[model samples]
Target: MVVTVFEAYAGLARRVLARPAWLGRTRLVAVDGPSGAGKTVFAARLADALARLGSGRPPVVNTDDLLDGWDDQLTFWPRLEESVLTPLRAGRAGAYHRYSWVRRRFLPRPVPVPAAPVLILEGVSVARAAVGPELSLAVFVTAPAALRLTRAVARDGPSILPELRRWHDGERAHFAADDTEARADLLVDGAPTLPHDPDRYYQRIARHPRPA
Candidate 1:
């Protein structure tokens, strides 16, 4: 499954990275999935693919880093407005100090994201909830609950199973309620054993029309 996910995600990344890097144009690419759906791994692999395809650098802005905290967990709409959302809208790179949930606040030092042609934001609700329609692509990954639970337990250890299971259920429900899967520009399966290449995946999105 990991292999398949890697290739599929890498395929999407290649499409994104292949774009011309115009610092003047800021493009946001969001990857959304359920709690155990493997968005983070896909995002990184895709970023790498994009870099390889473009023969350039790929900068990433993860929602996890900017998140407020568990108190407002999965509620990234607010910080995004003041941080990534506003800056990107202004045609400026969004800059912000990454939040340290364990510390209950953001780090003092700020991180500068370039206003490059592509910016990857990967997380649970990134695609459906944040950033109004300027996305070059909105990807949604999915997999069976049984498979996801297996992956989660493997990654987080057995102790976190109960909590992870709950989170996964909640995320799945939210996506369904939001109709995100039906609206996804790209969807990838996370259960297969084959590698999901990026180039092919991204070309699919490039060919998809705008949501009506």
Candidate 2:
């Protein structure tokens, strides 16, 4: 009983549509996972699946954009709540400025987050208590630590491995305190996600595009 990606996505789409809208005008879906656990790709695929079902292409807001830098970590939640989540919760357009790693500063422009019927929020700490109550579906994605570290290094380079390791340590502590995995509506095995094509997962992260 192996489920293909399409099947899995279809199931996810069904679950999303079936659930009552939790956030004001939108069904907020959180894709919470460790680094290199395929959260980005899974969110994209799920968004695609939702669109195919006529749910309209939901916008994805990565927590990466909200972070000040590698050190900022989960500390940017207040900004996210005020700028994005709060507005969306009121059924208005949410807005947030994206942090630019290259520039070492947040872009002056505000990225518009529309009040959508469904929205995919992917990245670590996305499903923590502050935002969890507003989420219609909370998904926790996980892969083997060795594999995740390897994938992360392949994407971020070996020079930052120590930093990534430190980041993971903080994430581990946060997750323990938050019980993120325990609250997930779905726990996805990220290993098999995007099996055939891997580049789609890295393109957004590795290329470091200006945040939308």
Candidate 3:
């Protein structure tokens, strides 16, 4: 049955909380999807839901903030692994410098991620195979290519269309190699056709069936 966005995410929060902490003392929730596919918004809502169901607000680390530039794309994982994941895996607080797209450099100050009961990591390819074992929940958000491009252009402005096109191409190649969608525990419709309260509800395409 269809559920409100809070109901859906609250239920997920329950399941995640019931699971053992796979990323050290934190339950790592990876929200991965293509650019402009609504991963950020969804992650924020999910984090809120998780907070309602758990102790405190879960920390969300957007991979986009970690990138060096347009070229860094997937290659920024190493920096994330070193500054965040590795330390977190050892039950320590993690911190990382955010990249300023306008300044084209890493910010001098670091963002701290305290070791909490839950952590939400959102961005394209954040749920890659290497992270599978450590993930408490892997959510893949997606939308039609045209809609994705349009939304991206609207958000980032028309000037980025050329770079966005190239970015989309890279995403296609990376997703194909990673089989990210198939590996996801939950598949979310970033651009849902069904009628619902956009702010309070989300369309879930499907939940991956578990092995018997």
Tens digits of per-residue lDDT for model 1 on 1-212? 12222334455565665554332366678788876676776677677766766545657777778767544446766776677667766688777789885687999998987666688878787777435366777788777777778887887689876666667666777787778776777776644444444434422222245557
- For all predicted structures, in order, the TM-scores are 0.75, 0.86, 0.92
Question: Which of 1 and 3 is ahead in TM-score?
Answer: 3
Query: lDDT rank, highest first?
Result: 3, 2, 1
Give the whole-model CA lDDT for all candidates, comma-separated. Answer: 0.67, 0.83, 0.88
* Candidate 2 root-mean-square deviation in Å: 8.5
Query: For residue 75, what is the lDDT in candidate 2?
Result: 91
What lDDT tens digits, residue by residue, belong to model 3 across residues 1-212? 33424236677677888988999999999999999899999999888877887488899999999999999889999999999999999999999999999999999999999999899999989999999999999999988889988898888899998888899999999999999998898888888776766666677774535668
Model 3 residue 38 distance off true place after TM-score fit, in angstroms: 0.7
Per-residue lDDT of 91 in model 3: 92
Q: What lDDT score goes with residue 69 in model 3?
A: 91
For all candidates, the clash counts are: 14, 0, 1
Poorest 10 consecutive residues of model 2 by lDDT? 199-208
- After TM-score superposition, the amount by which residue 102's alpha carbon in candidate 2 deviates from its true location, in angstroms, is 1.3
lDDT of 1 at 34: 79
Candidate 1 weakest lDDT stretch, 10 residues = 198-207
